[model samples]
Target: MKISEIVTILDGVLVAGKDQMDREISFGFASDLMSDVLTLETNDLVLLTGLCNIQSIRTAEMSDIPCIIFVRRKKVTPEMIELAEESEITLIECNYSMFKTVVTLAEHGIRPLF
Candidate 1:
């Protein structure tokens, strides 16, 4: 699914990488643990998490995750946004909890990493 579709589905705000909104994403993984995110091996992955920190952006960069959705209305810092922009990662913010974010994505045809 396209990032635009995901934004619509999750009612998210595109906080960075607006140009990447048309990018296609095939799989999604939800986790707050950076260790778990580091173990993921997939292409075109969208990471859904509540960890709104520079570390999250770094983990996504290291894992080659193209997009990240910050759930539960987490505050994404300017440092995080700057890092994401530099890393070419798309950042989105949503009011839904992580569970709801995952469920909404699944219901909209976004598959899990497994």
Candidate 2:
């Protein structure tokens, strides 16, 4: 699915990288642990987490993740947004819990990065 579609589905706010809305996402991985995030070796995946911080952006950069969804209504700070923008990673903030976010994405055909 496209990042644009994900945003619409989650009723999320685009925190940064609005230009990347057309990017395709085929999988998703949800975690608050940056260490776990670093273990991913997949592409076309979106990171879903409630850990709203600069480290999330850094982890996404290291893992080559193109998009991040901040769950549980967590907000991304200006610093996090700047870092994400620098990495050209799209950041989304949504009110859904991590579980709901993952389920919704899955129901919409986004496979899990298991």
For residues 25-86, write the lDDT of model 2, one tens digit per residue: 99999999999989878967999999998888999998899999999989889999888888
RMSD of 2: 0.6
What are the runs in model 1 whose C-alpha is more than 4 Å off? none
> Taking the tens digit of each residue's C-alpha lDDT, what string does model 1 give over 62-90?
98899999999998889998999998899
For model 2, what is the alpha-carbon lDDT of residue 21?
Answer: 95
Backbone clashes in model 1:
0
TM-score of each: 0.97, 0.98
lDDT of 1: 0.91
Best by TM-score: 2
Candidate 2 TM-score to native? 0.98
